[model samples]
Target: MIEEPKSLRIGPDVGRRPSVEQVAAFQGVPTGFVVDAMFGVGAMCVDISPLDTSNVQVAGPALTAENRPSDILATLGCLRYLKAGDVLIGSAQGWQGCAAAGDRVAGMAKNAGAVAFVTDGPMRDYDGILEVGLPCWCTGLNPGSPFGTGPGQVGTRVMVGGQPVETGDMIVADRDGVVVVPFAKIDDVAARLGAIQDMELELDAEVRKGLVLPDPIAALLDSDKTEVM
Candidate 1:
């Protein structure tokens, strides 16, 4: 038979986090722009959304945790690893029957310097979480409580919302959804963000000026490649 495992596993702290200046670059930036910078990727699954629209936009380094279904030991353990401006991410293997976190947990995260909380599983105590003032994103809410059991890991990589997120990765989220910018790609994504923002602004202006069909689509319709049927 297998031996008993440790009640909780906490990995080493993230050795490299983006500079405050780099993290600030994403503050208040729309999730769409971040996704565009990542070549139309990096978005979390559509189901995970903000607990409230009041505090939707958030950007910070990720502090990741992974827990078994209907359990929250890993999430609780991650608090010790959280740094100021960190975004706490908990992966519950997509379990929705029980909440991965609740109001008290949100309060703890906020006190621990976490700017936001995100999980692939549902949460509880919606009103209390909002009052705690920690921005949160999850699949939904469930009154069911989770156990503080073992078989969980903290301060390591975790898969949240179908995306592989690790400590030190940048997490940018808003009312739209959450997006992850891998730690290795932070500078690269930042470099490309300006160009994407410029292009988006230009397109928005054109659309506001009563432009209907885009140039590419119109050209395709008028060219020999098109056939009327």
Candidate 2:
């Protein structure tokens, strides 16, 4: 007979992490810019939004946890894995029946050195979380509580906000949404960011000067490619 599964399974810590300089490069950068750097991908679903808009905007390597529906054992376990500047990504498999985290959890995450908490499921203890002052992003709020029962995993790959997230992946979030940069693509994305920022800045300047249409769109409208009926 097969042995019963463990109540909790904590995977090995991430073997690789983005360099400090690389991580710093993403600090203060908007989620939109990160998406552009990745060629219009990497953004999480829009439904996961900041709990406190004023406290939005954070970038850090992820410490992932996977929990079952109406449970938070994995999230609680993941806290010990947090490093300074880490972002705790708690996955409830998009379940919203109960809270995935709350004020006490947020306080624990902060004490563990996590910069932010992101969850695909809803959360509770809104006022307490705000008082704890830990940045958080979630689908919404629920007053219901969750169980601590296990069959959960920590420091493992998880799907959150409809995106596959790994422990070492870089997570960037703001008022717009969360974005995940795969660990393998961190350097490549960072290399491309400068050019993207330059282009965006140039366009912003042109828009300030009362430019009506973008050059590409204008060219398309003028070309034979356009047929007016």
**The best candidate in terms of TM-score:** 2
Report the lDDT tens digits of candidate 2 across residue range 1-229.
9998798897776544678998998998889999999999988898899999884689999999899999899999887678899999999999999999999999999999999999999999999999999999999999999999878998889998888999889999999999999999999998888899999999999999999999899999999999999
lDDT computed for candidate 1: 0.91
Q: lDDT values of the candidates?
A: 0.91, 0.91
Candidate 2 clashing pairs? 7-151
Over the full model, what C-alpha lDDT does candidate 2 score relative to the true structure?
0.91
For residue 78, what is the lDDT in candidate 1? Answer: 86
Error of 2 at 43 (Å): 0.8
